[model samples]
Target: MISAPLTRRAIFAQAWPIMLGQTTVPLVGLVDTAVIGRTGDATALAGVALGTVVINMIFWTFGFLRMGMTGMTAQAEGAGDAREVEAMLLRGVVAGVGLGVVLFALQIVLIPLALETMAGGGALDDAARGYVSARFLGAPASLAIFAINGWLFGRGRTRAALALQIVMNLVNIALNLLFVWHFHMGARGVGLGTACAEWISLAVGLAIAGRGVDWGRILSPALFGGGALRRLFAVNADIMIRTIALLSLFLWFTNAGARLGATALAANYVLMQFVSVSAFVLDGFAFTAESRVGQAIGAGSRSAMVRAIRLTGEFSLLAGIGFALLFFVLGPALIAFFASNPAVRAQAGAMLPFAAIIPAIGVPAWLLDGIFIGATRGRALRNAAILATALYIATDLLFRPFGESGIWWAFMASYLYRAVSLGAYLPGLLRTIEVAEPANGP
Candidate 1:
């Protein structure tokens, strides 16, 4: 078995690299916007923005590949199943690339449908369509990279994962500048540049992931047998459902903000940046929990598993409190940084208290998600998401009379529901290690 010390220092070692990697993610979007905006072409900028939303929405549907790959591979690593570890990556890559191809093939139908819902017709539509068309070409690479990154994370190769992210972002940024500034390809260039960067990153990722891998084990028929594929797909499907349900809650939140008025919508948008920032930072601890907990489960060490959860949870808790304090102290300045409109700034400031405490309130839910994901408890996750979402919507409606503040309260309520609902499954999760095999293994 893979015996690694489970300690707070180990948790920090795992988390910092992930946090650094996540920090670069938002930079890519900023670069995309900056390169496009320099031309002073509002239509092109808006098109690129809308196209990004559409592409992200589509790609997110298959995010299960990344999460599932990490869980399965981590478990295999914990079990000291060298063969299974390699096989997990192989299966993940195949499924990722295969699903990406399907998405590309259906781009004609998918792009326009997504655009119609998200954008108006004419030049804007055409610009968005152009951007999406070019970006869609890299769908396979993008998805494949997801699997590769997942594998790296599972192996606790956080430095490699960090390098992979930095390479992709830097390459994308450089190419975007070259395409927009030098070639004048507008939104199409932006999309193409990102697509090309993804492909290049995939090449690098493969070289890294393939190092010392046992091809014989990965290519074995037993590894790709019907039973294995079924198990992988089952976990993936459940995670997908869970992801979609969670996304719907946010989408509804955004829609609700819109109904409140343009000011509220804009304010909420700015406020969401706070939530996003916190999530990005907190994900480091959550991801650490994933690998550590997965290894603990795989080794069937209940104490290790409990230690993993407690340690990671503690770090996340402290980080969340830190964020809350920072937001409360610098709330206005940060609000000003994100918003220029006095009205928007004022509204966002009014709502800042709600956003400020979210990281703290939401920590348990986020940490629990990582714990369950590591355990491969997909059914528990799926059920909790559905129930939590339903309660969120019900609470939102119930709080309708309070307006925007009520919505924020309901949003907070969703996090609580998710934690409580999933928390209910902890006993069963712990009991699994007492058995011969994990109850929820893929």
Candidate 2:
């Protein structure tokens, strides 16, 4: 799509930027925590944390805006459908902003219900409510930015995407410091900062993406064409359900750990950070696979699709192994850093081996997700995710008697199930590649 051949160099070129952008995402939260914690206001700190959790849960549900946009836009680009490419961006933006508006409208009801369920009635709930109110104001911008970034990734504009992420993170950090440290507005200040940064990023994203584009056709009747709208919604709906299923699995995992004891919960939380870090890094390759495979399919080249899978898989495997080794060698120190409490640190250390091996064990599942996402095989993804999650819950319940280690075992089993279930659909996905080889081709 970028007029460059797909090679390892090209793949890394696309991937590294995405990885860097993803890694920056956590920094925004870290800055919020640091600025709020320094005030010695434990209530404010906890409120911000709770608020963040709620916002992430809500926003993540709409992540289909990004994933769906990426697949559709990449296919359009691969097919050399320049008009459709532009239309896809407009459709994604409209959908994103529209969904954000719906979320904003529902905040009055959603906020109280979510906070009450998570924190119950207390000063904590009030504080979290304040934070959520401020942060939720930028819902329109935040969700719209997801579509913008997805469009950029679909077009293989990784550098542009990375640039936007860096800009947003920097803006967020700066505003957070000013609001929390200087203004001393507490948790609300943190939320306000993030919201302001999001609006700024939205403007910046539009400016970047709108350059050299024909807005006339993009805003035309074809943008709302019935068939296209149906396909877009169908894909988005499937991805959303698939995402929710995975979220449910992790929620269960966390809830199960909580039942074990406070120390176990803290240890599990710390251990999850290790998994998250590796996931963000390895996601680079997964994302690359999505774009490449989508392109190959769009062009109706099964050979190209095979090559994409092979190359992305190889890179993902290597990166996963590297992460596992790093986690194994530095397990104790990392645990100590995340968890200062002696009991939590020790509990996490005992289970560190499980976390260490997870990157390697999780590689296949992660890669398969990318492959399917790229192929835009939403039904296959949805089915696999649901089935795997059910199996995971059963395994978790069956191993409940083994204590914390059993939870880890169930977690590992979840990854295996995901990989296997997705692999089951991969053959059918390949069959959908409508190949048309040239008669004189060697």
Candidate 3:
């Protein structure tokens, strides 16, 4: 019986918890910016902002644990392979923890290189170092949580995922207040709080996962054998490279803003927050795409995957539009809330329209990303990213004479290109799958 693949109720059931969970993430950043900005020190603010970006680059690069795990595990789940799901979780957690160890070991060299690339050093460098060093403490725990979260999402345990995230973020915020406000610990305090929160969340996730699986059955020598290992590495490596390329573009954006100096950097930093918040919202639907699409494939239901994609993509689009409108209406107030420095505020206010336009353009790009991840379409993603990034660089150069607005234009255009590029490829990919089935029935 071919029917609608997903209902609005089904989509909402999946999306709402993810959205609510994600909402708390920005609160941590907002709190950090508000508390640190209140210190009336632009240099410190810029350092923390820059530090945050660097930390994200390092951590997010390993985001393959979450993404790769989610797709694989969700498919296994839909196929009713409980043992495979367990192995997937174990593999992700193992890889994540190992990568975290490597990151911590390499941070000393990595931090300096990242800083110099941004032309960051001096007063700004000192504060950023303080912040990043503190964050480094939780690398292992943070990655562990990534693996844990991915597994939870794969199982369609959205509410549990939501609870874990909310607890983690709340812990971060509380500690941020204690250290930065009361103890006057500065940027280091912010980092430490975030680190501690990550470890705490990992503990909670482990407890939940423990209740669901027989660990003795989940572990096996074959888990690391030729076929399974090769698949894991191949999938994760693709996603990792894709992630690195994407992060590089954003890092380059921040670096460009840095060359414009502290005020511009700070302003750009705050504006990116709006972008992040919008992403978080749309990501709710993206996640749904990952779960539902993977599940449908595992169950051999092409119609289900098609239906899930349509519903989730539409939901993401609507959510994105809402973000754009919110930014347009309240851009200034939010900018003001983030920065007390007059110059930073002024610069950010001028760029407000660009910020407002991001979600609208980002809607399709983000939706496609989720779709791709669900289908495990890494090569396509990598190709699109390469093409989009090349164009983005060229666009940035072409608009250089116009200064920051030019940069903003280039940024906006790059996202549009990403969407158009991915959106174009998606239909062809779907057709192949659709054609693989009988004209009338599966």
TM-scores of all predicted structures = 0.86, 0.89, 0.95
Relative to the unseen true structure, what is the Cα RMSD of model 2? 2.9
Rank order (by TM-score, best first): 3, 2, 1
Task: Show where candidate 1 strays beyond 4 Å.
Answer: 30-53, 115-134, 176-193, 258-267, 334-350, 400-406, 435-442
When summed lDDT is taken over every stretch of 10 residues in candidate 1, the lowest stretch is: 433-442
Q: What lDDT does model 2 reach? A: 0.82
lDDT score for candidate 1 against the true structure = 0.82
Q: Which residue pairs in candidate 3 collide?
A: none
- Tens digits of per-residue lDDT for model 2, 1-442: 4234678898889899988987777667656655665554545655665666677777878888888888888888888899998888888888889989999999989988766556224666676788899988999999999899888888888888888999998999999899888898888888999899999999999999888789986777777886777888887888999988887787677667656654665567667767877887788888888888888878887877888889889999999999999999998876655455677678889999999999999999999998888888888889999999999999999999999999999999999999999999988888878775466631
Number of colliding residue pairs in each model: 0, 0, 0
Best by TM-score: 3
lDDT of 2 at 29: 64
**In lDDT terms, which candidate is top?**
3
Tens digit per residue, CA lDDT, model 3, 1-442: 2112378897889889998998888878888888888788888888888999899888998888888888888888877898898888777777778889999999989988877877676989998999998999899989988888888877778888999999999999999989999999898889999999998888888887667687898677787775886797698787887888788888878877888998888898889889888888778899888888777767767777888888987888888888999999999988888788899999999999998989988988898888888777778888888788888888988999999998899999989878887787787667644323356854
Indicate whether candidate 2 or candidate 3 has the larger TM-score. Answer: 3
Reference-based lDDT, each prediction: 0.82, 0.82, 0.84
